[model samples]
Target: MIDAIMPDSVRTAGRALQVWDRWLLGCTFVLLALGVTMVYSASIAYAEREMQNSAYYLIRHVSFAILGLVLMVFVMHTRIRWWEKSGPFLLLLGIASLCLVLVPGINAHVNGSSRWIRLGIVNIQPSEFMKLFMVVYLAGYLVRKQEALRNFTQGIVMVSLVVAVIGTLLLLEPDMGTLVVMTVTVFAMLFLGGVRFWHFMLVLAVGLGGMAVLAVISPYRMGRVTSFLDPWADPFNSGFQLVQALIAFGRGELFGVGVGASVQKLFYLPAAHTDFVFAVLAEELGLMAVLGVIVLFGIIFARAFVIAHQAEAAGQLYSARLAQGLGLLFASQAMINMGVNMGLMPTKGLTLPFLSYGGSSLLASCMAMGLLLLIGREARAAAWGRT
Candidate 1:
């Protein structure tokens, strides 16, 4: 208490460091730095061939990372109440960005999906921001509708419609991976907000049914399913990526081959720096390095959960829920990416968070990390008292 009598600047500095979320900030920096190093390693070969520079992807990814860090710091220092105030505006912006991506002149096309908007200097993926926007808006929405949560007709049906609208737009991107992750994040937050059991069950049933229909309607998705069931059926064709990914892990027994020494990255493993980066990581860094990555993510989740609990205990429910939602997002996306690499699940073109090489994804990851830090900051402030 005597510290309150100290100089204001020193007092504020002490308060910021003592805040509940310094650990999360530290962890995020460490993971992000590691991600930069690995992205450079995984992308150097491809960048050199395609872009005429080994540092092409690395430079771009690092640039985005820097931008993301700035966003995180800005958000961390912002008031949570301010986010709540701007919820609808953010939601509208997210939806508009999504719609713009579908526009002919604006949207950037990659592979088969038109999921980005080419803004003069950079292509922006609105869906990435939509992920966080949906989470924050949903949290605020659910909190406002808490009284109605126990109501069967008003709450349940209403939320289902909300999910349907968002799901439809996401599916239009034909990004089943992001849609699935977003669905899970929403449902989890709603469930924890006391949305009730039967409602979740009903939503799950409808969602799965919709997913099935989507899969059957798309030839490529159907091929993914078929390939998943029997990758060896078309060993040299549709199954090549999985087969190569498996071989990457098989070769990385105990110690890794060595950092940046991956043979698979020599153009054999498709998306060696993006969707299937984990496979390249396994091949180059070995099994232990892969395990290390898993461990790092685990620590991140642990820290996030701790922050959530502390925020809740400190009476900051919004901050608490925000932390939890971000944690789930991180955990779920990582699991999906890793599962695809391991062939434990059907392939979904989801980037492995910060570790993957993609501008939109990297920016989105930075935004999410920023939100997490914001929540952490509030939790810390509440824990230690305002300076």
Candidate 2:
């Protein structure tokens, strides 16, 4: 109806604005809304017991969701070239923040890991932001050294050195989960950037070996590995969390008991609203809901790759790599979280993207999605310009 009255130029401009991928954006908002609802369902009783308010976690999560959406909109409006230009500086800042979190008296330790920096009312996890920054920096690096990536000495070695340094910092915090995600993202980006097949395999082997060594050296990690292998062996201690999670899933055989009626979230399962929210979701919403959630994530991942391929076809190499990296980042984290919850992998503190209760992860995910939409827009614009 507005189109009928609007001037030609105004309509054209509006149409251009509509070029951004609405399906991707819709999937994002659906997940966000689902996250808010599930977070409330999973945390209300716990929050009331611990914080004396049933809405404590819900309120904070809503606030963060609002902030994340705003930031995402801001990123969508910003030019991608600006990100490319600032990538290095952002990476350096990320490194500095990671280092700062390890320093005495400045970092906040939770569950025996120092990974957060308290800023007045909010505690920021630098590693979460580091993932986004590393994507930006690597995208730029790949664009700058596309040809050199074919050479092991100049491309593979140099990128590995940078990743090693970052991995070292993360290991200091003992955040093996984030380190693994970061390593996989970098490797995928390098591979997509035309690095030789052999080089990619070699790096993959080294990364897996390093992670194995790290797991072996830490008793806590080794215990987690053993527990993952046989959570039933010590159901009361090391296996407690996974065992409870499995119980949640088993209880939710088909249709769940009902939303907000999860018995496990009352106290049985740990981190119900944060890391293991998916388990709570499965417990309360059932297999259908679980499959629905998986399908939603699948849509996001598939659309992201489509956008990447489109951008690459349009000669937007940086945008292509960034989009691909973002896809992998989201898919990998979600898979890892679900895998941990379902006993397929060792328990990791990785949150499900856009569906877990965490300010940093939510904000970073929104920003990444916004960047992806922007890349899709540019790809469309470039195709239009060509025509």
Candidate 3:
């Protein structure tokens, strides 16, 4: 009825506006739905073996998804100024949580790395929340110091110091994967914030150089690099995970065996429901599933930048930077996880954003999406001349 009264041009513009906000929310829902189904499929065997309950992970995941959705709604409704003002405190709180994870008794140590904090029902990964906080904190910082950021010393140095401190704490947890993602995302945000090209390049160079040194110095990391180069070299040992993942992909071929029918997730693939869920997904759903997931993410990644541009046009610098940072955060993590599964990159303990079975990750991704929605709402309002 509304469309009938409007002119054709106005109706088309309305559809264009709907495309941005609707696509973001729509793609996220699709991913989250897929996450639930895939998590159950990939974890059924493990959950049954470990917890004696076939639906253990499924129940927990549903619980967290509900919680995350609730939180996302709250975040979207909250005032923007509140988030901007709270960024610093949230960043400091994230730093504190990271510290807590390193302490004895309180920290949940797993696979030689201390990353989670036992929160009764769920073990929360501080690094996940840290990424969100860093984006929020940095976005606000960039907006506050826009002019200063143009200067090499005042802007870049100050931000780098904070990131360095966070990186050191993350290294203490030995979460090099999260550290790399966080660093790269920060660098990408810096570029979007309009930092000088050379300064941005310098930061990128230093970050890359530091990663190389860290890899060379650490036997475990170096082994990963070597194994990634040739997972077949020691297929039953260090390269076991990637080799199994590849096997799963090969089994998947073009179409997939069937849901809940992945042989690899039965016992061969480690972290089947977590880091390697994509492999299990491929084995069960085939190449078409992979392409679909990639396309959905492509829409999300591209739309985030559109929202950022919209925010910029609306004179919302903080929102613009936040959207960009969050966009890179999602895309980088997803790409890295998929790359690892495909044997294109060294194995990293990164979740595939909304698609992985991790409470912290799901919650963080939801909150980030909520913020994007908030920004998008304001931009639309500003564009439409609404109060």
* Clash list (residue pairs), candidate 3: none
- Model 1 residue 25 distance off true place after TM-score fit, in angstroms: 2.6
Q: Which stretches of candidate 3 lie over 4 Å from their true place?
A: 1-20
Model 1 accuracy (lDDT, Cα):
0.79
User: Given candidate 1, what's the lDDT at residue 282?
Assistant: 84
Q: Model 1, 253: alpha-carbon shift in Å?
A: 1.6
Residue-by-residue lDDT tens digits, candidate 3, 265-296: 98999999999999998999999999999998
**Alpha-carbon runs more than 4 Å astray in model 2:** 1-17
Model 3 C-alpha lDDT versus the unseen true structure: 0.89
lDDT of 2 by residue, 164-275 (tens): 8998999899798998888888898888889999989988898788789888998999999999999999999999999999999998878998998899998999999999
Q: Model 1 Cα displacement at 279 (Å)? A: 1.1
For each candidate in turn, the TM-score is 0.92, 0.96, 0.94
Which lDDT value does model 1 have at 125? 78
Predictions: Cα RMSD each: 3.8, 2.8, 3.8
Report lDDT per candidate.
0.79, 0.89, 0.89
